[model samples]
Target chain A: MTTDDWVAIWLTAKLATLTTVLLLGLGTPLAWWLARTDSFWSRCVGALVTMPLVLPPTVLGFYLLLLMGSQGPVGQFTTWLGLGLLPFTFTGLLIASVIYSLPFTVQPLQQAFRAIGARPLEVAATLRASPYDTFFSVVLPLARPGLITAAVMSFAHTVGEFGVVLMIGGNIPGQTRVISVLLYDRVEALEYTQAHYLAAGMLVFSFVVLLGLHLLNRERRV
Target chain B: MKNLTLLAMPLLMTLAPNVHAAEVQLAVAANFAVPMQKIVAAFEQSTGHKVLLSSGATGKFYAQISQGAPFEVLLAADDETPRRLVQDGQAVAASQFTYAQGRLALWSAKQGVVDNAGAVLKTASFKHLAIANPKVAPYGVAATEAMIAMGVYSSMLPKLVQGESIAQAYQFVSTGNAELGFVALSQVYEHGRMRSGSGWVVPAQLHTPIKQDAVLLVRGRDNPAASALLGYLKTDAARAVMASYGYVH
Candidate 1:
């Protein structure tokens, strides 16, 4: 691959890494609340958080563009905070990917949290353990597999995302042109050989991540 | 079982014309939306045949047509696509003609953002400058050409935001993500005047003529309606509509 090709790969990895990190940090609390809470409003909020999984990524991006444009409320808020508008930039792309891939992260974490059961936390509470102590000491350790799955899923999904990235990122090389967008550009330009190479690379990368997760799960089951 | 028969009766009635009904599919480019919408209406009014239209980027449409989508007519953003379609036997030979010439403009929804000379790009007042992807969209190619001619390609490269098509490029500026973007002039025109947005119409000398072309695909050769629309595009009435929308003869 050329230097430009490597640049795309690097940017894709960076974007995926940042998106996964942000999703994990933000998703844990929300996923916990959804898993533990029984309120009707909590379920509604949970549904809204997972809404992106059902939306076509391009449609989601279209809405996001309006929400994150200069005149949009979110954009105005960001601008007031000195971050500028949130479309057509690398940072903007991260925000879009995080929202787009939220369910991939949150769903897995929620399932994991639920699997841990409330019995452990309740027992810890009886033993005079604080909520924070029980969470860090008991809950988090048990939910490691779920967190890993969520992170890997989020990262991989972010890397593979095309429609939303194209809609919001604008595919500027060395800035916002991630690997998937570059692959699309190659195909559109009739550079089939380059497209094939990039596509194959992505296929292998995604397979490796998924295979690792499945192997871990198998070992745990064993 | 009595209710089942009642439902089957209407289903059978609809399926009775299986041999007589034929659908003519047309793959249209995004920029040809207005003119093609009119032509389709007129053609259907005169011929009494349905035209199923699917509009998208010309590059994607070309890829689909090459893969043997059942599209009978292709209204393309550039002449090259129709020529390629004909050469590949996806389209009828000698059935292609330049239907309209497209115009490109640097537009901004923000007041006074785009001047007539387009000097704003050089100063880099805009944090993002949207344009269609030059490798795929014809309007993008023109936008790049205009940027190159104006000596802003390098300086603006860092701020460049490339859309898959002119439609999305317009969306970028219209949504105010980027201060301005290169768009089809037709997108910003209404009734012989430019819309509320500021625009700098790029000089023709900056780029190759965007000669939009229409071709009857291989499947369309036998469809009378498809042929009629292709012919209708050249008529005075159609030409006037195209002209009003900033298309050249």
Candidate 2:
């Protein structure tokens, strides 16, 4: 592989890793609220969180460009805070990937939280344990499988991201040009050898990731 | 039963010899989209033919064409792609011709941001300067050549943001995401005036001419509507539409 291809690979890995970590941190509490609550507001928020799952990524990218443009409310706020606009930068891409992959993290984690039921909470309550302490000590450990799933799913989804990034990324080398974007560039430039190498690598890598996840899940079930 | 016959009537029309109107599948370059739309409208009106248009980067169209896409005609953003198709035996060598010559411009959404001389590039005041991907769009290659000719390419490289196509590069500038961008003059210019923004038309001497070529693909030889569209493009009426969009003869 060429150095540029390696750069794209490294960038994609970094973006996926950062997005996975951030989503896990943010999605856990939100997933918890959805799992524990039975209110109309919780349902409303849950629906909002899952919106990206159904909408096309181009729709998201289009609205995001408007929202982050100089005339946008977010843009005005960011400018006031001295951060400038957020279209072609790393921070902008991170914000986009996190939103795009939110459901991947929250859905799995939410299911795990719900599966835990109330019996464990009641047991901790009888022991006079605080809700915070019970969550860290009892709930988190029990939800390990869900946490792993959430992390893996989000990582994979972010790695596979293309459309939204294409819209906002500007395709700058060593900046917004991730592996998927690089692969697309290769194909367009008629560099078939480079394109084939990247495509084949992605095929193998994706299969390995899914196979590993499947085996891990099967082991847990057994 | 009545509606089924109504639908079948349209299908039967293709079998009738008197009706020459047939569908022509077209793959058009993104930069020439506006002019092509107007041309297609007139061509369809005159010939009663249905033109199914698919527009994107020329590089992508070349890839799809090589893979034996069912496109009857290709309107490319650069001359090279059509010539390559002819050399590869995918298109008729005699059917290829220059349809439009493109002009590059440094444009800004805000007034006065881009001076007529395009002095903004040397100062390095802008955070981002959008340009189409040099790997794909011919306008992108022109922009790079101009920047290099002006001796600002090295310093300007850090601020460059490569849009997937000229259209997207225009979007970045029009939306004020990038303070300025290099785009086709047709994007910012209309009939005898600037459309909405300020632009400096880059001098032609700095870069080679952007000769956009149209070709009838091998799959299009049997399709009368396909060749008809190519002939229609050379008409005075079609030339007028292209001229209005800042494309040269």
Candidate 3:
């Protein structure tokens, strides 16, 4: 691969890593609330969080573009904060990735949290354990497998993202051009050899990641 | 029951001919979408054939065609792709011809952002300048050539944002995501003038000609409808539609 290809690979890795980290941070509490809450509002919020799952990525990207454009409300707020516009920048791409991959992170964590049930928390409460202490000490350890799955899934999804990035990121090299966009550009430029190489690399990477996840899950089950 | 069956037989026979109407799948470049829509309508009305247009970047269509996409014809924004397909034997060598000449323009949603001579490009006052990806869209290549000929490509490189197609490049400028962008004149031209925004039509001398070409794919070699549509594209009615959109035939 050329230096430009390496740059694209590095950028893709960075975008995936940052998006996974942010999703974990944001999805954790949201999943907790979703798992424990029984109110109608919780269901509404849950549905809202899962909307991206059903919506076409391009449609989501188009609205996001408008929302983060110069005339859009988010753009105005960012401009006020001296961040200019968010459509073509790395930070903008990160924000989009986090939203696009939210369900991938949240759903798995929610299932894990729900599987914990109420018995463990009740026992901890009887032991005079604080809610915060119980969560960090007991619940977190039990949710390890789910957390791993969530992290890996979100990371893989972010790495493979294309439509949203293309719509919002504008394919700026070294800034917004991730591996998928780079692969697309290679194909468009009729560099079939380069495109094939990148496509093969992605296929292998995705397989390895999914295989690892399945193995981990099997071990947890056993 | 025999009497009813006899009455329905003539109706069924008359409707049977409509089922034989040929469908031609056309892969059109994004820049030609506006004019192509009208041309397709006119062709359908006159010839009784259905035209299904899939518009996108010419490079993307070329890639798709190379991968064995089931398109009957390609209306491309550049001559090279059609010529390449012909040379590769994917398209009939004899059926490839220039359909239209695309005009490039520097456009901005806000008025007066682009001057008549496109001096604003030299000023470099905009924060972001959008253009179609040069590797994929011919107008993007022309835009780059124009900038290079104007001696500002190097300086303008940092501020550039590349869209995947001309349609998306127009989106960036129309939505104010970029201060100005390079798009096909057909996108902003209407009624012999620019419909919205300020624009400067890039001179032809600055870049190589954007000769849009059409080709009959090998898959459509035996389809009469495909050949008919190709011929129809050269008709005066179709040429008028193209000319209205600022395309030179």
Candidate 4:
């Protein structure tokens, strides 16, 4: 691959890593609330969290573009705070990716939290374990599989993001141009050989990652 | 028997158009979308042939055409892509002709932001300046050339934000994201003047002429409707529409 290709790959990796980390921080509490609550509001919030899975990436990206633009609400507020515009910046892409990958992190974690039941928490409570202590010592250890799954899924989803990134980021090299966009540029420019190489590399990498995930699941089950 | 008939209904519905009126699949560049729609409407009215217009970046259409896309005609944003198609034996060489000359404009949603001389480009007032992807759209190439001719290329580099097509470049400016952008004249032109935003029509001498070309693909060699549509594009009615959109013939 060319230096440009390498740059795109590195940028994509950085974007994916940052998005995954941020989503983990944001999604965990949301997922925990979703699993514990039975109210209509919780259902509504859960549906909103899962909306990205069904919503076309371009549609979400379009709204993100509007929302993060100079004339939009978020933009106006940011301008008031002297942060400038968000579109076409790395920060804009990171924010978009976090939202786009939210479901991937949240859904699995919700299922894990729900499956834990009240038995472990009751046992911890009987032992005079504080809520924080129970969460750290008991809940986290039990939820390890789900946490791993959420992190991996979020990372993979962000890495493969294209439409949303394209809509908001506008393809600025080293700032917003990720691997999928780079591949698109190569195809448009008729650089078929480079496109093929990049596509094949992604194909292999995705296959290996999924295979590893499956193996890890099986190992934990055994 | 009833179930089988029900299953075949949707298949029939999909095939019904081909069995009825003649249809021509046209691939149009993003910049020509508005005028192409008007031209297609007129052609359909006059000739009774249905035109299915698919608009996108010209480079994408070229890639799709080279890969055996179903498009019978291509209205390209640049002369070179059509010529390349002809040279590659994907299109009829004889059918290729310049359809229109596109105009580039520096547009802003806010009135009076852009002067006639395009001096706003030299100032660093706007953090983002939108332009189409130079590798794909001819208007973007013209914008780049104009910038270089004005001796502001290097200075303006940091503020550049590229859209996938001229249409999207217009969107960025219209939405107030970039503050200003280089877009096709047709996007902002209505009646005899710009509709809402201020625009500076870039001088032709500053950049290469954006000569849009139309050609019949090899797949359309046997399709009469494709040729008829191409012929209709050159008529007075279509030419008038093009002219109204600031396209020169």
Output the lDDT of residue B238, model 4: 92
User: Which residues of candidate 3, in runs, are more than 4 Å off?
Assistant: B1-20
Clashing pairs in 1: none
Docking category of candidate 1: medium
Top-DockQ candidate index: 2
Model 2 chain A: worst 10 consecutive residues (lDDT sum): A69-78
**In model 1 chain B, which range of ten residues has the least summed lDDT?**
B13-22
Ranking according to TM-score, highest score first: 2, 4, 3, 1
In candidate 3, residue B142 scores what lDDT? Answer: 96
Error of 4 at B77 (Å): 0.4
Q: Estimate each model's TM-score.
A: 0.92, 0.95, 0.94, 0.95
Candidate 1 chain A — worst ten consecutive residues by lDDT sum?
A167-176
Write candidate 2's Cα lDDT for B85-180 as tens digits.
Answer: 999999999999999899999999998788899998888578999999999989899999999999999998989999989999998988889999
User: Which lDDT tens digits does candidate 4 get at residues B123-199?
Assistant: 87888899999988888999999999999999989889999999889988998889999999999997779988799
- lDDT tens digits by residue: candidate 2, A147-169: 99899989999999999999889
- The interface root-mean-square deviation of each model, in the order shown, is 1.0, 0.7, 0.8, 0.9
